[model samples]
Target: MPRKPTNIIYSANEKPPAGTVLILGVQHATLALLFIVYPLVAAAEAGLSFDDTQLFITSCIIFMGIATLLECLPRPGAGMLLVQIPNMAHMPLAVQSLAAGGPALYAGMSLVAAISQLTLSRFMRALRAVFPPEVCGVAVTMLGVALADPALRRVFGISGAITPDLDLRYALVSSVTLVIIVGLAIFSRGMLRLFAVAIGAAIGWILAAYLGVAPEPNASFATLPYIDIPHLGWPGVSFFSWALIPAAIITGVLSAVDMVGTVVSMQRMDDADWRRADLDQAGRAIQANCLGDIGTAITGGFASASSSAAVGVAFATGTTAWRVGAVSGILIILAAFSPRLIGVLTIIPSPVIGAILIYAAAFLTVAGMELILSRRLSDRRIFTVGLAILTGLAVAILPGLVGLTPEWAQPILESPLSISTAVAIVLNLVFRIGIRQEASREVTTADNPFTVATEFLEYQGDLWGARRDVISMAIPVVAEGVEMLLDTGVAPGKLEVRAHFDEENFDVALLYEGEPITIPDHRPSPEDLLGDAHAVARFVGYMLSKRADRLVLGTDGTREKLTLRFEH
Candidate 1:
């Protein structure tokens, strides 16, 4: 098993105290509820009746709760502390569906989107190569980048028409909230850091209320029942249309891609030794997310996706226990029945939520940059990452370009997460055109043997996208092994070096017309270490054995082969 990250207070399998779990669960549920505003936006756009909108929100929350629970389980889930919420990205298409055919059309289109996600999830394992580290990095980075507009808009009170005084109050509240969260996460220890976001949000809410910046509940709040059972808002049958199918399918694919990045972020948070994404696990996560969307669809709710910003919250708060996520799921499901709880959560100051999102975005952006540099970079990879970023940014910086895309493609082209991910995957494949997984070169005493071997391995490592540590370890061990072979007269003539990488292991084989050098089972004694040429050669052989994870001595036809194998 890989090491748990030191910053993570609780891992996926570990259980926190019930009290702590409940507290954290409430925190997550509160965050997830904030996204319910998206469904409300669609409801208003479609001009639904108040009761219809209420039913839609209730059903969405219930399914999001169910999906959140599934996401905490290992079999159908990505098994991380992930929260599912209404997907704002799908809001436009959902509105079109709602306007054209009412709740039934919206539910049907959402089901199609769910099926689309399910289809993509099945092939996630096979598509690993298409989502290399840098590509995944771009997706994760854009997840953060996509949050920037909403976060800043809320922080500055620019999302709504506001007086200058109100805008300043929003800024003040958001800044204070952000500072408390960041300062606690950075400077405090133990429980303070564990509840950084919760504490910050609490303080921000209080300040907002004091300043009259927090939303005031209307007289309708007094008439709303404290608890009400949730029911399906529309009939269960799926509605389908050739015209809407493209939008639905594209929405599903984009959600799947978004889930991929979100799962990767969660994986990185839990494991200190995170190498690459566990796409198999990620596939299961996508499946879980799709299941949630399916529930929402059948219930006449909106489409849903895993929340990337919530992962940032987990990272910032230092807790990612599945127990906490499961607890949050329960609360969310219960909140669907509790109008009072929903009412209280709904009034949370937008600036406060914006501060929390800003905090998450900061962490995710930096984490994505680190992930991008985790592997050796070649010129091809540099362009793949650089150009993908530019393409994704263009969508954000130039909103008019979304209008240029066909209606079917607009859903994908409009979002930074989808556009950057598509560009990165395509560019990565395009750049791999001439790059081979295996390479070979000849080295001899006539040439600078070490330099020849070093350059060959470095180039191949970059081309094959080998782990940096693996390549770094391989270079020196191969160099020393070659010197030992020639010095000990095991291979005095020219040699052939062949390198191969399969993402899991890196193998370098040296073929020569000589006998195999003996690697001692134990470390060489002081006498042997200080002894003549042969003792020195034996000592080098022993050290080489220690360097590589496995050292193989074998023969290929008439020539003897020495191979160094490193686990990536």
Candidate 2:
């Protein structure tokens, strides 16, 4: 049975508490720095001039602040009023798209993409039933699995299977950095763990400097000479780039899905009631993505997504106050005014950032696996889901296995997000439908009552002791059992026990007031025969007739404790 809701006092008006703001602010700054490093490096490698790189970084900061601010302080119907984070899933795809189209095309494609997402908002709710926890779990796990190789490449500077001569010096520095980070996380308490990634990166930067592998950090604040308006360019409408449309759509949708899941999970963890308005509020938070993407496109940067870091910061620092978002925006605006600082940030070594990325990606993978396992799927369902995930991963990691020509399928297969989404959807549908006939056949002749009785008995012996109060146990019992207990005058505090055959254990409990009581033991002697359900029902009926406040059955501590309550 579901647990009752508890009241919690939350100050939704004004800004979040001061403590939350600080914690969330720090977290936001850390993740913003970490996630932006990749794009900066990729843009630099693509032969963007230093000036362009600075502009890009400046735009990123501004957009991050804008998106974060809007999410925290929603504008009527426009914002989701939730914490948002940078979108990591779209990075590889955006980078590839940028590489193919250059700055102008990249901007145009991004603009179109943002518009598409906004247009699709109306249909977003319709997708909920199709992407249940089970399906989402598989897709999310596949996402993590697919990104594993890219993470390794960034860490080690490997190209495909071709490994470069080991940069032993760089490797050693990264190793030491990771060690310090892991150690701190394990040994340090509270806030220290939260900042471990940032701390590790700082240490790695220093080490790189000592090794003479890092360039001198830029400290000036020069404005870019060229600030062109984002003029619309031709969209990448070729078959190759057009295939990317599905990938883009999947990214947007899955991101929304992830945000929803996060909100739901946080509410459950906090033991708060989930209002319908909260769902709509979450959707509005995603609107910031559209706005952020527009700004990113205009400034020749990749589109942005909602920031989970913001949520973490909010929770940790109790900064639910709206002013913190304003503070973050102010800081970002200050960053934009300083070109040299942005320049310095753009030069951080890939391996240093890559080390952190690798760890975080691995963590994501583990979390995905946990999500899958939490479904408690049957073995057959497991096999189907596992097969789908593996197939999707193979398509992503080993495209050659599919034997498709890159020229023809490269665009579609380019992103793991798209490939995995397709695979999961198709396989999930097949499995769900394929098993229907078998399920129907089994259901026709299945003895559901016997199965339920057997399960109850087994649970009683294995999980519930004979001396256990049935009323307390009944609290966690299924709905049917709960109704049955209620019908028996098992009020809040009374206890009753029902015993099955010796081979089967039975236990139940009913909540009385806020407390629960244990019922007396019910043990059958060797000579005494146990009655069937009809007889058990009669005994319970008689007990209810007597208005007994407490009833107990079964042996003590040996399982099979059944208790019922009659009063508050």
Candidate 3:
């Protein structure tokens, strides 16, 4: 098991105090709600009326709450602190659906997306080869990269003109917010660190309000009731359209990619020894999000996915307790009933949101690098990762390039996250061509056992995409075995070192022409170590047994076989 990170005040399984959970939950709820803009944008684009738009937003909030609560449960969820929100990836298709066939079509398509995700979940383990650590790293890094534009634009108040709309005051507010968050997280201790983001954002809000830059909730308070049950506004499943299946499927696949990336990052955050993506947990997460989408479909709302920004907030706060998610879900459901409360939360300053994104982007970028470097980078992998990043970045840097693609291809190329992930998966599969899982080499009497073993294993490790640490452990032991044979004069002329990997266990077999070497379970005594020079061979054999997770010695007809196994 991986050790818990030192900065984590509460892990995924441990429940914090009620007050702490409530505070952290509110923090996450606020972040998740920030994504409410996507559905609101879709409503505006579809030209929905005031009441219709309100119903749409309300339905989205209710389902988001439900999904979040589901995520905190073990059976339906990843059982982590995941908060679901309206996915930006689905906004385009949703707007088109609403424009074409009203809320009914949108809801119908959402069901399609839900089914797509549920189906995708079943194949996650089988698709592990396509989403290797490097590819996942690309997806995670792009998650941060995708946030860069909106974050920087908000921070600098840039409106994309010859003269940038760089407002120094707003920039200062953002800087202050970021500084407080970083300072508290790094320099402070205890409860302060746990509330770093909330404290910083609250302070930023106050500053923005004082500057008259942020709208006060008082202006909208009179327009909304304190509490009222939102109408379900189910558009009825009878309004389905077969023509929109392609768009709905596209939305589902892209949302799955987005959800996968977020879950991968969360897995990394929750476990210190995170090696590869935990597909089983990720599949559960997708299943939970899809169930939420089905509820959204029933209520005539947009599709939803796991919120990467909310994950970042949980990571920054250093408390990913599922109880926090439960509290946050309840709060969100309550907010759905209270329009007045939603009005207040919606008025959070853009600069504050930008500051939080900046903090998250920094952490995610570094975390992605850590995941990428977890394996040995052969030339093939380097190119695979590098080109995938370049292709993904191309879409971000040249947004117009997406227009050149066919209409069907545009959705995949719409964002850095989707484009880069798609390309990385393809590139990883392409580079995997020509590399065999099992290979062997003959070691000569004149050859340096260590050098031959290191070179051969390193090559095979790269080809097999084995974990660097696992291969590092196996190399020394394999070399020691070969050296023991040569030193003990057991094998003469030629010896065969065979390596096999199946993405689980890495086994190395040393085939020679003599009796199997003695592998003692315990350490050799000092008498055996110093009594004779040849006694050192027994000590070497003992060391080999200790290094390998399992060691087997046997004879195959004319040759003796010694095998060293490392569990991946």
Q: Relative to the unseen true structure, what is the Cα RMSD of model 3?
A: 2.2
The lDDT of each candidate is 0.86, 0.50, 0.85
Candidates 2 and 3, the one with greater lDDT = 3
lDDT of 1 by residue, 34-152 (tens): 89889999999999998888888888999999999999886677678888888987887888888888888888888888898899888977898898889999999999999998998
Alpha-carbon deviation at 552 in model 2, angstroms: 26
Tell me, by lDDT, which candidate is best: 1
The runs of at least 3 residues in candidate 3 whose Cα sits more than 4 Å from the true structure, single-residue gaps closed, are: 158-163, 216-220, 238-243, 524-539, 554-558
Identify the runs in model 1 with alpha carbons over 4 angstroms from their true place. Answer: 160-166, 517-539
Q: Which portions of model 2 show Cα errors greater than 4 Å? A: 1-27, 34-60, 73-105, 157-161, 216-282, 298-301, 306-330, 399-412, 434-450, 453-568
RMSD, every candidate, angstroms: 2.1, 10.9, 2.2
Better of 1 and 3 by lDDT: 1
User: Which digits, one per residue and each the tens of the lDDT, describe model 2 over residues 1-568?
Assistant: 1222332123234445566445545545544554675567667666666656655655666776676666556463233224334466656556666677666655666666677666655555665434544455565565556556655665665645765576666676677667766666557655555456657778988888888766554444244322333222223332246756665665565565555544433333233332112445545655656777777777766566654434433333322344555555555545555445445556776667656655545544554565554433544456656776776767776767556654435444555545665566665566555332111011111234234434543344232112223323333332233334334333322322233311112223322221122322343333322544333444443434334354554344522334533331
